[model samples]
Target chain A: MSTQASPETVAPRDGGDGGVPEPSPTAGRSGPRQRRSGGWFVLPFAVCFGLFMLWPVVHGIAMSFTDESLTLAGTSFVGFDNYVEAFGDAAVWNALGNTLFFTLITTVPLVLIALGMALLVHTGLAGQWLWRLAFFAPYLLPVAVVTLIWQWVYQPDLGLANQLLNALGFGPVGWLSDEAVAMWAIALLTVWWTVGFNFLLYLAALQSLPDTLYEAAALDGAGAWRRLWSITLPQLRRTTVLVGMLQVLASLKVFDQIYILTKGGPNDSTRPILEYIYDVGFTGYRLGYASAISYLFFALIIVVSIAQLRFFPRQEG
Target chain B: MTGAHPRRHDRFTVDRRRFLRLSLTASGAALAPGLLTGCGAPAPGGDGVGLKIWDLFSGGDGLLMDEMMDTVRGGPDGFTLDRTILEWGPSYYTKLAMAAAGGRAPDVAVLHLSRMPGYAPGGLLDPFDLELLAEFGITREDFPPALWERAQWEGRLYAVPLDTHPFIVFYDLDVAERAGVLDGAGRLIQPGSPGAMLETSAALAEAHGGAGLLFGHVTDPAQNWRIFNALYAQTGAAFDLPESGPAIDTDAAVRVVSFLQELFDGRTNPNHLDYFGALASFTESRGAMIAVGEWELPTLRSTGIRLGAAPFVNVFGEPAVATDSHSYVLPRQERPDPARRREAHRYVAAMLRQSLTWAGAGHLPAYQPVLAEPGYAELDPQSSYTEAGDLAVLDPPAWFAGSGSLFQDRMSQAIQPALLGRASAEAAVDRMVRECADLLDQPNPVR
Candidate 1:
């Protein structure tokens, strides 16, 4: 069904400006008036953005400079002290390392496994709808529900994972308790829960690939494997880049599942930077220090994003 | 172009206008009940004294508290109780702090006595009127001196003592009998010392064909700290937090950690068990005994297991156990209502009088009168550990030391490696001293 509709959907993008209809002759004369009317329509969104997003950013930056706390205690301006302390904080460094390690482990598998699933589904597998649904269903679940299910599965003794391993003559493993294995277990669950979104992206990219290229490749005696390597993979390059970037950014921000699962325990091995901020701010009652650490993390994310953009510059038509 | 489809456009515009009107009317109809209800309910209690109480009680304790609240609601005092049960731990405390800071806190809330120093000094809680409490028949004399003193800050009473929940031992009666560890009165014969405790555990292990004791040492920092504190306290070591650092006795701390290592050597007790796992092990008969807080009494009883409980045995020179109390505190209010404050005091007094019902869940009541009652002593297993209240060793007074506080978290982190056999007991003690120094170096954020 998607095959017949692909050409019509793909035509506009490949054709670029050629696919555009000519503007009305009076458009230039009425443009300012139309723009004025459009401003009214955008005003509500502009107000919301300024209030919620812009205000918090400005306020948080201001808060990072003081000795603010959760107790509404007296505050003092401690110029650069919080930041200096954060730089010297060993816990902050440890949490950041854990976050980086998690991003490294989860991103590669999430991207590759998603692509494999999409490729299988795009090959006209029988019951296309079922395969697509099965691939995408886990992404629809809330993180709480996902963690609840995985918590049971990861239980050391009576859990299904160990039961299966025991049946196979292997000893029980502490999936959530052993310091060495906790992060890997959390990463595995995260991959299972979120690989669906990436799969859907890849599937759409696969479906939208032009059929004429495949036809030409087949005419040149290209087998399925060669076609996949020489044509399909290269065609999906932009999609792959997008998927990889999104996966890394998403993985770095991980907190909910790990927080619910282990509270970053078995000696804080799985604690991410975000959980550290939460612990310092709410649990430890040190909001100003938490804010400084937050800005440091924010700066790190920006640098990583800029590097990604520079290395994989967007493809222009 | 405008005139070409003028008639059809006119009809479409009219239909769109009608649809908008109809949709608006439909939405208004849908919202009518909610709007009415929002304004219709009379201030919750219709001129009666309404007390909003927040507590962190769940499991068997939650059910018992619910029953107590129900009785108060139905009593002749004409008091209406609005209760909220929050999740126990940092989340609950965080929300309470935020609410109190914002001046929108509940009339009364539960606060750990150990946490009183943090909150009371910060003015997050208002001092209670002793005369008012006395009017309600709750006096300072009614509580243990240590608990009452801990509930005060800067010479004013900020909390009313509730119950002291200490680290205790739960054993399967049948398993203990099979292992011949019970005494003449069916009480668990005291292990008395570390070596004797290990010997008894070995015997129990032989009888049960599994770990003799189930101590949840994995991933549960609170449990780790509780057991450590209880054992360390038994050493008669002085623990004080000074500005320089935690004044923990190094040799005593190492001794306790070494004993824990031997206890969790994978035979006497499984080192990998977690909170729920320990409960399961004890209930499933895989372990002869489990060492945990007395709070698990009702849960174990529900499983239909033949259970018995005793106070934490003396493993060193002194008989001491780490304990904390769940007390009632009046959170600071922007505009304190005299009548509502009075009602809160009454509610707490009423709850204290009903301590026997609370005792069923295994906490020793702080109200001394309740302990003297015939009914309290009749409670099996619960009454067995009444001495724990006197032997209680609360977390040392510090801004960061309390149940679910940062001090406990730090202690747990430092000691967990040793418990897991990844670090030496001496090294773990060093880490503990260093971490406590770090905490001491951090400026007190609670003011």
Candidate 2:
């Protein structure tokens, strides 16, 4: 996947040449004096990335070791104290617990269902463009828009969710009202709003699948389901693996969904880890603590992503 | 559904600090160049003397201040006003703290009096001199003493009382007339008991197409707890012991909690959240009454909703309503500046002097002179609750206390379940006391 996608795309054409020096190993071939000049190109970005992004990451790591806040004159470096405190805070654990549960509930079904949509649309079916448009339209909507729609739909009185329930002579689900049903309700909204993107990715991958494999499978008296299970699934494995990992990471940082619906809950039941980090940072004025939590989260995400990369040789195959 | 989506449109918000830091870094990046080329000015003086004022009073209050400042700046040349306008609520306080911590605070700012203690213990405020205040003609005798008490920290003045905005019970007078709740002056009469309130609420409910009496949900448990606090104050129930143990467990408090629980009709929640939601439906005459901050009156009036203001219900048969005062304060500056300080003082004085004009919008004036202004009593809603400032009830001063921070969040969290009928009132109050104990016990060693 990496090899196919790289495209050897250089940085933005002209590449920071607003009076900035050109950076290339070509300078080394030119001469020793010219080779030293390329350092200026690397210098500016290195300073910016180090200062803005990398420095904060390091500072956050350092802060995670301290039990200090911004109010104090000097942060007392109480080693591993914040982490211990964070673990004890039930709210933090609840957020993490909710985030993991939401991720598992949403990502698996979303990817598989999106895969089914991709397969159906990929087949020579009627109203091809209509199905594609219908499936892909919602993905273009913003998170706030999608959430707003769901918020109205999930409203208990005079809402479409309850209205639909009543119409079916079923019990009115407390979609975002009750603690028990809220996360799953948000997951359902997630499936509707974002399944399109995964579907598009899967469709693109399936389009690129070699026709010969399916034709060969068909020649052996393979029906639609058999062909899909053997040829189609194997062919789309790389895209599926990539999308699954990406979706898991995406779902873990679910802020806007939970924020709009339930707002971390009836009893902090719907709170996600990212929302907790945000609450700690901006809302509570604990930037030091929020940054520390964010970095810890970053490490966790990196570890999970690395584990995904471990599965890549087979994905490539 | 159309209007329900919060219209989120973003303009670029580059903060002054970040932008300054960016400019500084750019300038610093040019420092080597500046030293080499010698084109830059010297770095700004840390010891510079000038008046710095900060406040979160925007919209009409902001415009009035702007016009007032332009008049001041253009007036008899005595001093300069270095001003900063910060967005209000949580951001305002956070910025205030960060500025004080980084030692870049303004010399004058508006601090909600409820917030004084939190900043005070940290030495984030410079105590104002009574003698200095007397020269400015601000005497303790002139202002309401209860509000005046909110501005002091440790027997010293940290802030001057500017104005107080209390929750006034607003009713549709047209609906009230139908309910036969008329005073001798033909105004809406104030109810004085839990039963009288329910009776009046039932009357208002019947008059307004039988919609429930309250315009908002019990999810506003701070207001509910405040109702309890007022009742407890009347019945003499303390959440703390005569000196020990949590006393929210007291009998009077339990009765108050039960009484509040009874106010819910079992019909429905407001089907909305927050002030915006309540204010919207109230304007449409969906409900007959709402208890809300005075700041919302002008907005409601602008919606063409006729309103009558009364003191909140006297639950234990004594008048009590929660109030929070907004005062013009000086955020601490790192350096000393005499003249700039005087100008900041003059601006606060002038704003207070023009409090009648401020109240023309919505707020109740804290100044005695402003209250005595001719035709001050003629303003409809402002006149109605004008005396509410004279007898104010504020949240207890603590580091954890403010409008929507930990205290409100915890109080709201505990009581909202009971409002939903998910938890009993006893269970809700129990949860509140238990949680608040931990927060109260979370000591600030700095304090």
Candidate 3:
């Protein structure tokens, strides 16, 4: 069965099941002759991969069981003490709750808003190229730049946001000071900065959609909205799922925006788990405990990814 | 002319896309090592001939340090000074720790006085000799006893006192004049007591038609901790750590916390402005007074607003003010050179003698000689608040207790709800006591 569902599926026709496509029946008979060359070609990547990526993972897991500190000269084995401390630590729980709250508040809007933007731009908007560029431009900016822009925008008294509200006859809102509104303000900034990536993905999916389905629905006396509901929505299902899953993972690991915008402030209302881990590892100098918390978070990410895969098993043709 | 080698040349022609890819890969490979270390300089311990100093000063502080360095460089010390400015806070400490660990730390460095205990025990700092310091006319008696004691660890002096920057009250002179709170000399009259201070704030609030006293009580845990420390110091309470528990004065803690909560209850003092916002409100005349550190003196002075600064009044019945000092420390050297050590002492002494220049940047000089300089007594705001030097209440000595340490951050976070009116003052005090107990329970890894 083919795992390729989208029109631009990654699978090649002859290799739909696995491996490179066999151009002819005897293609595999010559595979051994090319295997050694392939191994030589992969040697440099494997070396670098082991040195930078694989070593850190293994070392981090080992350090999680010891009492390692960034500045201290020595460490001793502490078993699972750090993990136990984390389980009972209120700060950890508060940060975890904040992270999950941020994820929920951001993921749904990020997915739906990107879909809406893609549809609007794809509906023969004037200056098509400009619309595409504008929709996706924010994704290219550095996270620092995005947070800096929003920081000024969210300033309570003399900010542009309050000024806008004043013109609309609304009372000034404490965008960064109010604990209730601070995280939501960050979520709004996240949506504005990152919706561009998902928008581009949806736009690609929409462009690749076969026009024949819409034409057939049109012939059956369907209205424009009906055509969108019947043809466009269903065709975009796989991209929607992909976008949602990507957004959930991205939102779960949020650190940069919160670090710059709030530093988990207004009483830790916006503090996420990663910031907690950072505080432990770098700021607090408890590298071992920090590693344990991070590994726990890493395990959580893996479980979530597996659950997503089970729920949205790849469709095949 | 090259017809004979035409086929060979054609075989080596590169496409734009492939050439671009190759260039990117090459540049990235060349940049990887520097990116990993976060610095591009050749390794730290170089020759140890001239003074290799490290500091974390920027903006106004940076300007003052630059001026001082220029003076020292032109002096007859005849030794070169190589200065390295690191990003402040943990990043600076982390790099300093790593460099000391690698036996490549600079010859001289500046450290927060509160951090000395932590660094001293970890062997990241070297002890200074009293005889060497006295050769340059800087003796133990020339410093404030409270600050002088903080520069020691394990019965040895690990840091030399530089300057103390304390948390103080900055008031708008125009507003104070309107409220009739200023004396004949245009200085704010010291409130006799906490009750009197609250009345003064209320009167100022009525005159300004808004909150009178502004503080960064919303998100700045540091400021909240400073205020608490100041008030707690006034209660004459001490932090006593037993083997596995905290011995705190709960009554004093409750009293200070309750008083702070009332002070920021939105009638006399608004509790929501951040550090910058509070400063902005004071400068813009939206508020009559603000409580912050003297580091903001430059920003306030540049505003050209009618301003007056005073050491935090005896609001809690004592004139104590919370403060931290920046001092020179010698990072531990794997191999000590006598000549360099002597040079470091001379450099520190010269800097101390010129404390008048440093005072211009809004720091209270810890060196007693500078305070007696003929010109020092005439400096406007610095002289006005000179009493804070004697009144400075240093942070509690612990591995975690310091200006930017986790102790302040954690305690402030726990107590902020009371400031914001979300939690009862009693409950906030209880929470803080419990958190302090937990922190005390942790083993001192550095020790």
Indicate which candidate wins on TM-score.
1
TM-score of 1: 0.89
Candidate 1: the clashing residue pairs are none
Better of 2 and 3 by DockQ: 2
On DockQ, the stronger of 1 and 3 is 1
Model 3 misplacement above 4 A: A1-41, A129-134, A159-178, A314-317, B1-50, B241-243, B336-339
What's the number of clashes in each of the models?
0, 2, 0
Ranking by lDDT: 1, 3, 2
Candidate 1 DockQ vs. native: 0.20
- Residue B214 of model 2, lDDT score: 54
Better of 1 and 2 by lDDT: 1
* Lowest lDDT 10-residue stretch of candidate 2 chain B: B4-13
CAPRI grade, predicted model 2: incorrect
Cα lDDT tens digits, model 1, A1-317, are 65335434543432232334334345455778797997999999889756544555556667789888878698888889999999999999999999999999999999999999999999999999999889889999999999889877887656789989999999888898778999999999999999988888788888888899999999999999999999999888767776787688788878889988888886789999888888887777777787788878877876775566446543422
For TM-score, candidate 1 versus 3, the one ahead is: 1
Of the candidates shown, which would achieve the greatest lDDT relative to the real structure?
1
DockQ of 3: 0.12
State how far residue B297 of model 3 sits from its true place (Å).
0.9
Per-residue error for A74 in candidate 2, Å, reads 4.7
Residues B284-335, candidate 3: write the lDDT tens digits.
7788888999888888888887778899877767678998999999887667
Pairs of residues clashing in candidate 2: B109-B329, B239-B247
> Which parts of model 2 are misplaced by more than 4 Å?
A1-39, A72-74, A116-175, A188-193, A212-222, A256-263, A278-299, A306-317, B1-53, B57-87, B129-132, B217-235, B239-250, B268-275, B443-446
